[model samples]
Target: MSGPGDVLDLIRERRAFTRGDVLEITGMSRMTVATRIDALLEAGLIIESGTEKVAAGRPSRRLEFNTGHAFVIAANVDTTHTTVALTDLAGRVAAEERIEVAVADGPDVTLNAIADRAKHLLADGRIGREDVAAIALSIPGPVDPDTDRPSQPPIMPGWDAYPIPDHLKAALDVPVLVSNDADAAALGEQRVAHPGSRALCFIKVSSGIGTGIVLGGKAYRGTDGGAGDIGHVKIAGHGDLLCQCGARGCLAAAASGRAVARALVDLGKPTASASDVGVYLADGDPDAARLTQAAGRVIGEVVATMVSLLNPSEVVLGGVLASPPLLAGVRETLYPRSLPRATRHLSISQSTLGEKATAVGLAAMVVEREYSASAVNAALARS
Candidate 1:
């Protein structure tokens, strides 16, 4: 009884399908299936491969969504650098570029540099603006859901309530969706690494600490888009340090990459940022190891409380601080502290996407938003 549009919805939702599979799943007639397939194929929304092996006589051709028909421009903008990538509908980065732009310089300069980098990368990849279906942008700050603007983000001075979406849209001439960097990374991990899991909690420990949560296979942006702003959670008895967010004894204030750097400085070592700390750790510096481990313990305590409450199946540690020793420290504190039921099924692991996770997650957002059943149906109907 389902129509071709309904069948297409199933395919889009599942990301792949075959004619027989569609028929059986949707309970549609053979003629209806043929008509829908013809329409989808003609509309350039789906592609038929050689065949799928069933049993004996012959294999029926398998149909798949065509990724080449469109692409997404994704950017991950941090306080110290920006990484731009062009990805197809399949979430594969076709081209990427990294630029060191100080976000404190002002939004205009930083955003302009990013837009230019994106333009050059797209041209290098031979993908035109029309071929770019959408733009997914990740910023190292909290976003206001209603305004689609950056909130009073820490460290990146002079970018509060900035109209980021409008600026990027004007530059790229495409639809743009913006989100917090940690949230975007969470979505990326969900799409690429753990597609089967329905819920996930991604904790990013970079220049600052943050958390991203995905529920039911979608990023859960809380009211005002600040659900996972765990960086400001207080750590008892650590009241001397000042956080960039103007709070005292906040998690990020005491245990972020910046905090690690400060700890190293206090130990009489010259250090700049967390990346430098990571290099030191990699070079086997004992002091760096000690400071990072301490930071990890603090982060793990927070994560343990989160796990106990959310009961997520997986807890992914990411960003610059998710190093080996840091992970060990988190495990050292979390497993013993969290509720038994919550910690029992929890599989803690480092992020597989690495630094590019947010950029790729941005691309995934574009694909999910622009290539949905209704969008494809509208395109097919127009054609």
Candidate 2:
């Protein structure tokens, strides 16, 4: 018979299990299985889901993860918009809301909007205050991991030294975790799309250009949680363009979504944003294609440097402009620029999680930290 510890391990590893199934799988006696199941149920780590079938008997009861036992709030805050979602332990979005509120106005205004949206989503989802386990927030800036605060938010003019975690905690009465948006997206991709894979990098090419580095299955935030701020790396001879961070000829200034938009405008085109560039690129506009390809080349040069140094297993392209042309541009530049060994094993692919990556990553952070901890502790106690 499997020990109590073995049964708990099985439940934790496999997500959920039924008594008969557990008995067969764990090769445990019926009484021992029933005892362990009873303990887990009493401890609220597992729930009963009515019944199933056995041999010539009445019917066995089914079991599944109790999603309602806890909930998490995830927010993905971008320059142009904010997305809020209420998710359960199973990662299903119970309710979601999006607002056209820009996060560049400062911490006070943006965080208030986020708080309101979160409250509304929670109310709409019918989740009570006590049920919320934690709140994970993604900001489009570097976050001080130790303090969980925004540090020198360059694009966001008034968010410097803002106590984001404290502010959100005060507003929502729940524990809050703040991470860089690109980093969060990378973590989300790892958890939701590329589970068990290590050494991956997610390059976000939206309004700005940023990279998120994950080494050994953990988000590597460097010395001050600003390791992946590649947008500011200067490009040779492109000293005319001014970046929002006040740097001239930075990668972001030369090749971000905003850069593409500005380039199109300079070329006498009537486009306003990177999304517009995507539209034009899809339509095969020569100017848009030309500028996007150029941006991709510049970005690819920077990424090739990274690849040569880190040699990550996979490099995922994401954000609003990770199209074929852009990726082709990246591949075109990276293959020739990077070391032969680095390029040999590298797999460059588009983000499978898309726009939901940040939100999903935030939710995964909450689920992994909050529910998984409780579940594991409860299971251990039962054992």
Candidate 3:
């Protein structure tokens, strides 16, 4: 039987819809459509806009998804910094803050800091705790789907299987969701910038390299959540350079921002992390541009294989090192190596959302889960 949840699914997918449109689309009786719409309106899940003119009858009221009825708390945790945001159900940021908290500080300390900051953000926005629907976080590591914990992350020490969702849920008393940073950013880029692309790939060239895949408007987190851990893929002829995972000849060891930073430090540059390397690139440092471009070529060598396999419509470069030099370098190698058919529709570009991509994506993830049809139906049943 048609219910409020079913009607909502249709309305949310469209910009604005009318009862007639719903009837035609769902093939439901006028009474059923009216009843479901009325229920959704009463629940504040949807709102009536002005009106849409009809061919035969009087103008019908236009209905839209209510974006302001609830909010989400979203955060992105990197190696040396974290960003927290309060966003509406549509993933629009209301307020945000950045903190220099290290992920290496262990899950407890870092998560506590994030929780405190989140509370402050809510208080500042004058939003009540009950209004927050969920909390979502993106971390620079692989997360176990079943356990909702970091799964043997190479850079995040002491975070392996650390019960992240439970800790945050306990602190805030809200449902918590966790994601891989690259995966979240890929969703952000696809949802915000390339909504038409059915298949998209996002390569994050940060302290370490990672890949994110989005297929059919959904993130493709592989079984066990280890799908996009491309940084550990070995590159031939670099066995001398050891990776943080204790593996030699890894792609990240040879061509990631961390590797470029090490090279700069060896060349008497005062750079430490990938973020510092970004500053150097922004300053137009010749050495930084050169090394980053070279790194891009190396990364492209690996991405070429991904392009052939996935044949994504778009490939976005993100994270700290997503710049012109990197983009050019990837183009240099990716175009030649990938097959003509694979590269035909591919559009490679730098990130449009920049540092805020992960947070925005996390918010979208929360909204999609919390407001899904089954969830809405369950909530309506309880009400």
Best by TM-score: 3
lDDT of 3 by residue, 328-373 (tens): 9999999999999999989999998996777667877886788888
- Superior candidate under TM-score, 1 versus 2: 1
- Alpha-carbon lDDT, every model: 0.82, 0.80, 0.89
Model 1 off-target regions past 4 Å?
1-6, 55-58
Q: For residues 236-307, could you state the per-residue lDDT of candidate 1 as single tens digits?
A: 878888998887999999889999999889889999987888789879888888888888888898899989
lDDT of 2: 0.80
C-alpha TM-scores of all predictions: 0.93, 0.84, 0.95
Q: Count the backbone clashes (under 3 Å) in each candidate.
A: 0, 0, 0
Positional deviation of 309 in candidate 1, in angstroms? 1.7
Ordering by lDDT: 3, 1, 2
lDDT per residue for candidate 2 within 1-383, as digits (tens), equals 33444455566545345676787886767888888777667656577777866776668777754556677788888888888888876456777888888887778888898899888877755677878878888888888878888777778888878888888889999988888999888877887777766788999998898888877656888878897889889989789889989979999998998989888988899878878887887788888877787888889999999999999888899988887878888988988999899878789988987877777667656655555544555546655
Q: Lowest-scoring 10 consecutive residues by lDDT in candidate 1?
A: 1-10
After superposing candidate 2 on the true structure, give the runs of residues whose Cα lies further than 4 Å from its correct spot.
1-68, 372-383
